[model samples]
Target: MIDSRHRRARLGLVSVTALWGVTFSLNQVALHSMGAATLTFLRFLVASLFLLLGFGLRRSFWQGVNRAELLGGLLTGSLLFGGYLTQTEGQRFLSASLAGFLTGLSVVLVPLILLVLHRGLTRRQFGATLIAAVGLYLLARPQGHEGLLGIALLLACALFFALQLVAVEYYRITTAAVIRFTLFQMATVTALAALVAMAPGGGGLLPLHASQEAWATVAINGVGASALGFMAQTWSLRWLNSIEISVIYSLEPVFAALVALIALHQREGLAVWIGGIIVVVAMVLVSITPPGGATYPQESST
Candidate 1:
């Protein structure tokens, strides 16, 4: 029974990773009809609503919110906003494959950040970081000055995401609090994105004037990638170890690259492919080896 459950959990997590991976390409295509801020707002708004209706219908869920959870939600949400905004905006100038590889850098960044915070880093993690840096250089080297701004933004996105993971770890959310905590974070992102959309020249709150493709992307990202993905990961944790989960999650970039090339017809040169592979290797290394060889929870990528 346990083995069967574990197999199911692995499959579920892989499915969740694929959902996340596909979004890189989907959002890139969808950006043709909507502004990044508007897209971000709509995406999270949909996600927040879905989660609310699905899990927040209970009065107990609302009443369970302590001050700490509220604050944690705000902090994590701000970081998430930074991540998605930059990621979506950055995708305008980058191929989905490149964006995936760059975003996956957060895997390496998290351990390094934790190490800086005195969380202790193992030799394996240190080595992986060095390797990832080299991989990044290889990946970005061929692009030269091309998409430099997008590269910078995506790098920032990775940093913000890494910080968000650290913050989530610090908050130590419990099993019961997962739904409530995630809802708060999603709501916060939605509110912030709405504020951005309301600003002058920020585009209107709704993308009602946008194309059907744009609207569909928002729906898929919000309901599938954000809401359902979170639930899937949380569920999988019941059977998967952190290392197993992290390693599986690291395949997100690979899936993104494949989806872009095959499904979206995006093309990349040989150097980019090799560099992307190297980056994935670095991420896998970081995942299989925890910080200081101690147990650490590695969250999914954006």
Candidate 2:
């Protein structure tokens, strides 16, 4: 039964990654009419509302929320907001395929971050990181000034995402109430994004100039990618460690590439394809490798 539960969690995480992958193309479309800040604000606003409505239906949800959880949510949500903001901004200057590849650097970053936090890395993990680093260099081969800038921004996004993943694991260990924790994090992200949108010289809070297509894209991403995706991820982490989650999430770029090909008729160069394959292989290694002596917290269903 325990193994079956873990398998179910893995499947849920796969679904979340696919949803996130499609959002790359959807976000690119929405960004055509809306600024990054405005789009992020509206996206998380819708997501937070959906989460609130769903969780509010249960009395236990409210009782589960407290000051400690809210504080934890603020930290994790800030990291998450940084990641999304940088990724969205970077996507403006990169192809959806390239953006997806660059963002997947978080998979490489995760092990390094864990190492710094005193988690022992196996020889295999070190080799996988080296392989992934080479893949990133090839995948992000400079196309010029704009492309370099996009890659740099996406690297920052990867760093922020790595931090957010580690933070989520820490919070999960302490709190164990996945639904309440995710709800608060979503609310925090919504508030932060709204503030950015309303800031001086930033876009307005509402995407007033956006078209019907843009709105539809945002709505789909907000509900499917942000709200449901995040909740699913939080729940999955109950059964999976941070490294396992990162490895699973590495598949996101493959799904993004597929969506770009089907919807946008996009194609990358030969070098990019080879580099992407290398990165995927590295993630596969990480996934197949058994865990070391690191002390992962006990799995929780709540």
**After best superposition, candidate 2 residue 155: deviation in angstroms?**
1.0
Tens digit per residue, CA lDDT, model 1, 14-64:
898888889998898788888899999999999999999997898876775
Tell me how many clashing residue pairs each candidate has.
1, 0
Clashing pairs for model 1 are 122-292
Across 100-123, the per-residue lDDT of candidate 2 in tens digits comes to 888888888887887878867778
The C-alpha TM-scores of every prediction are 0.88, 0.93
Q: Which stretch of 10 consecutive residues in model 1 shows the poorest summed lDDT?
A: 293-302
What is the Å distance of residue 18 in model 2 from its true position?
A: 0.8
Model 2 bad stretches (over 4 Å): 57-59, 286-288, 291-296
Clash pairs detected, candidate 2: none
TM-score of 1: 0.88
